[model samples]
Target: MSKIQKIKGFSDLFSPESTVHTLMENLARQVFGTYGCQEVRVPILEKTELFARSIGEETDVVQKEMYTFADRKGRSLTMRPEATAGVLRAFIESGQCGAEGTTKLFACGPMFRYERPQKGRLRQFHQLDVEVLGTDAPQADAEVVLMLWTFLTKLGLKNLGLELNSLGCPECRPVFHQRLRDFLATIDHTQLCEDCKRRAQTNPLRVLDCKVPACKSLVENAPSIAESLCPGCDEHFAQVRDILDSAKLPYRLNDRLVRGLDYYQRTTFEVVSGEIGAQTAVAGGGRYDGLIKQLGGPDLPGIGFACGMERLALLYGQAQIPAPDFYLAVLDSRALNTALLLAQRMRERGFSGEVSFEARSIKAQMRQANKLGVKTCLILGQDEMEKGQIVVKDMATGVQKNIGQDDLEQALGFRKP
Candidate 1:
């Protein structure tokens, strides 16, 4: 028989690392709630067409990265490569868009993609996603961006760089698309990467986001989206900027920062950290005004963002687990029941406690207690039980005291207020 191993690009989180993961999720829940966003759970798998339509069939996510397959019924299904499309699908199918108020939802879970995994990129990864539906106000865009910024900074990530851009809405984007196409026609097609070349024929805006050195150099002098924005889009972008500025948030205008999604329009932004090399974008999101309607929902606009949980764990470092309040050592086998009862009582009273189950020597039990880093230890043995008392030892100070069995609660200061 062969030993089983974890598949490539997938990993198991253990100990302190898992603890940090919980901390990250808990913090996100608390912070996202403060922004009036409620939790929404969506399935990991959905109809393959959901992504093909929302993420655009021409984009890299749908073209090459999605983990798509056929079900037993020969129906196409795909493990979601991102959260936004799945979220929108749920919103439309559940009729949340028909509700009166704007829907602010947040979700966190694993997203699967088939791309080659690298340092911060994984085939199976996690994201902290937030979305706001039924609003076209630029303030909604600014608020979502600010919340993402606040969430990252609160996680101890420092020196973040904020980049902002706007992809004109449908009315004006077509004109810019033609202008961009015209410019690409003048350049030698051989200089562009294969992916860039295909994107040029399908979605020209994506060419500006190409990471290839040659393709990047070619687009350096390409026309800017700012000049082609319709008056409505231009005003929306200005207002988003003004709001960000009013809040004293600093950001740079990056004309080349067209996010790798087809739904974004009007306002787009990314928060990056230099600590993570090329995958510096710790979080990114933008407005998707047509997604809700496109997905068979009411005509409503939406904005949202997603942060890579793996990259967050890498930069968050290891978090320290707090020490237990008490460690109960069974110095005698006869006292085992008493120690277990006392530990349970302590826990019920809101004090964390642990008990040793093995019939080890007193010295061995004490050594284990020290390793647990407990503040104090309750030593129970035949001798102490005979006196109707328990031995309480302060691990840090090495001080010992004898307390009546009934007085254990008082001695530990756990006697309810």
Candidate 2:
């Protein structure tokens, strides 16, 4: 039989690729923690209705991209394409998503989407998600956006820009939809892509988000949502902008920044980078005020965003892992037990390195140290053990010194005994 290969769109991440992903996750914890955001983990699969109701049924994500299947009992389940829906579903089920106190939570995990894999996008992808629940205050929107900005800035990524927009709430959005629909009537249907044609009939606002050149050109002079914001929405959006300005955070107000998700309302934003090729969006999210109640939870509001880990890895450049401080070489079978003890002692005191598991010749052991790029080597031989000492060699200069076993810590310069 032939050897088995990994799935087409799935990847086996190792070393530096997995390294950067870990660093990004840790930084998210550090930065989000500073802002009072706690971590939460939710299942990757859920009832299909969870997405259909949360993300609009007409949206492409629910209509085309979800990895949905049936269980033995015939109940439909879907691999999550995004994180916010599952995050909220957990809080709702646990009774924490309510009008009590503001809950700032973050989670990072794999998200599955059945779309064609692109440069930084995959059929199976991972996302670092952050969400703020239980408050509809405009300040919540600014806070979450600012928090996301802080996390990305900490990543040392360059050439990144934030795009901001306000998708008017239920109050004034209906009017804009009607205006957009009328504009579509004047254009020839053949000019729009099949997806946009369906979007125009089902969810007119999505037509504005179509990336097709033809559809984009047609919507160029179409109605702008800014022109239809109700007084409440306009003021809410203005407050969000003013707060971002006060924080000295620079952003561009892209009239077309409506995110792909349907739950977004009032404030929508995306962080794009020129470093990542065609798929430039490194992260994007917006406020979803009605999603909680709409999804059978308390009538709470939420704002959140997800940083695409794959795209972020592309932006983070290469990940570097520093070599160990030293290596322990056991040259004689009689010294094996002693070498293990020395290795354990050094590690307990915060020193790190590799130790030979079995007795090996000096030539072979030193070669292992050289391959690891370690600067110092500690040799434990039968003679050295009998003398109650460990030989330390400087790999670079080929200089050697003998130190008392008790003096190993001082020899390594870790700290005082």
Candidate 3:
């Protein structure tokens, strides 16, 4: 029989990759929590209608990428391809929609999509999502972006630039939509990707977001929605920019950042890194002022962004294995349980390390300790067990000493938990 293999475009995360993932999540909690944003978790699977309603039906994510199917009862279900829709559903169902103050939430987890995977893009990828709901104020937009920027900087990511754009609102988008439609109509059929071709009819703005180089070129001269913003929409976007400017958060205006979602309106932004090849976006989001109402909640506003963890790990390089404080090596089968108990006691005292699962030769155990980069090694042998003493070796200095069992904590320097 052959060993089973992982599915294509999906991957197993272990070692340094898992370490980096952990670091990102820890940093997310630390930084997002500092901004008064509470952490929340949502189901990975949801009713397919949520996505179809949140992300437009014609968008690439819904039409091609989502992992959707009918359940045993025949009700259509889908694994979430993105975080926002599910987060919003949780927010609405929790009845926080009628709350007076703005609600801020952050989530971290895997999302599923059926698209072709590549560097930094996978079928099952993780995201650090941050969202702010119940406020349409431009400060909310600026705050969310600033919060995202702060978190990325805290993670030690460099060479990143923030791009800002406004997709206008329902009032002005129709006119820009028509103008964009007109320009897309003039492009020859050969120049556009199939996805962009469909977008040209369903949402011409998405055609501008096409990843195909040829497709992007064909729509390069398409009318910019920024130039067509309604007075209110224009004002909201301007204030967001002004706030960003006031905070010394350097940003560039990209008239073409109509993110590939239909829920966005007014302000949109992305933090891009040159370090990551062609797919520059490590994070992106915008204001969805009408989504709450559309989802049967109070007519409120929300804005958020998701950081792609895979791309971030690429920028940060490999993660280091944190060294254990000690390694307990057992040289007698009778001492196995005692070594485990001692290691447990060490842990209870706030020291972290590992213990041998079975008795082994001193040399073999030392080799294992060295491989794990443990700084100290405690030897458990028949003689030491009988004498009620433990052999403690300083791995760094290559020195050894026998200490009475009662003095082990004092000699090993255990700390209070």
Candidate 4:
């Protein structure tokens, strides 16, 4: 038989690692809810054109990274390579933007991209996405940045730095793009990749995102859009920084940090961690004032950000590791029915418990309890059933108490624990 293996650049998220996923997502939901942001769930598959238009057709995500395929009906579709485009599409298609006048939305789900996997970068990843629509003020920009930092700090992420920049609005970007194109023209075309070479002619701003050593060298000296920001753009950037400062959040200016997508505009920033690996930017986002209009909706200004749930999970402390409160041990075949009844009753009483159907010995069941790291075990066997009593053992203290059926739930601390 041939060997079985996962697809290249993909991984299995199982067992304890899966617990981390739940923990991070729960914490993010709690934090998001506190800030008046409601949760949203979007589909994983979308029409290919949604991305082709929302994310730039010339960008890497559209040109190379997308997992696109034609369905049996001959309609082209793609898995969501990123969350922002799909979120925006949902906003326009649902008419939520029009009815609500503003939508403060948060979403957490898997995102797919066909790229080489590395330490923190994966072919399939999970992200916590936050988006706000119908707000153009600099206050909206700072609010999202401040909320992200607050959430990270609350999670005990230390020394997380904020890197900020503004790619300027539509009216002023063309002039700067011309200057950027002019600067790239002088560089040796032979040294750059075909994609970067093509980007030079089609969308020159994206060249800065290239990691190639020679290209990075050429682009390092290139003029930043920040320097050429029109008066309005400059004021807006300054105001955003001032708002962040007023909130007592520390940040550093990064002139060349334009996002990979074309929809992003003024006020881009990332919450970075040195501990997490090179793709350590746990969260990043920016304003997209024209995206709503571009997607065939009314002119609406929006800003948002997304954080990698997998990376955040890796950083959670020991306190976040959850343990089942109770383990229901069915000693042998005779006690199986009793164990099941007790476990179900415990659930109804708002307590958590797990039962094993393996028909293991008392010693083996106790070992499983210890391995699961739970404190209390409700041990049911023929002897205890014959006496109409159940033995509750404290795994940590090795203490045992025999309680009758009438007081079983109360004695086990089902309602309290």
Best-performing candidate as measured by TM-score? 3
Q: Model 1, range 1-417, lDDT digits (tens) per residue?
A: 999999888878897988988898999999999999989999999999999999998889999999899999999999999999999998888877779978899999999988787877889999999999888998899999999988988998877889999998999999999999999999999989999989889999999988888999999999999999998999999999999999999999999998998998888888887887678887899999988888888889999999999888878888999988888888888888877887888778788879978557878878988999987888998898788899999888999999998888778755543
Superposition error at 103 for model 2 (Å): 1.1
Encode model 3's per-residue lDDT on 1-417: one tens digit a residue: 999999999889888889999988999999999989899999999999999999989888999899999999999999999999999999999988778998999999999999878888999999999989988999889999999999889888899999999988889999999998887778797777877777778777888888888987887788888779899998988899899999999999999888888899888999999887877999999999899888888888899999988888889888887888889999999999888999998888778889999998889999999998987899998899999999999998999999998777777765545
TM-score of each: 0.96, 0.96, 0.97, 0.94
Cand. 3 TM to true fold: 0.97
Separate clash counts for every candidate: 0, 0, 0, 0
What clash pairs does model 3 have? none
User: Model 2: per-residue lDDT, tens digit, 1-417?
Assistant: 999998778888998799999999999999999999999999999999999999899999998999999999999999999999999999999888644789999999999988888889998899999999988899999999999999988999888899999999998999988998998899988999999989889998898888888989988998789999999999999999999999999999998878888899999999998887888899999999999999998788889999999999998878987778889999899998899999889888877789999998889998999988888899998999999999999999999999999999888766623
Q: Report the candidate with higher lDDT, 1 versus 4.
A: 1
Whole-structure CA lDDT of model 4: 0.85
- Candidate 4 residue pairs in backbone clash: none
Off by over 4 Å in 1: 413-417
RMSD of each: 1.5, 1.6, 1.3, 2.0
Off by over 4 Å in 4: 1-3, 317-320
- CA lDDT, every prediction? 0.89, 0.91, 0.89, 0.85
Which residue pairs clash within candidate 1? Answer: none
Better of 2 and 3 by TM-score: 3
Alpha-carbon deviation at 149 in model 2, angstroms: 0.8
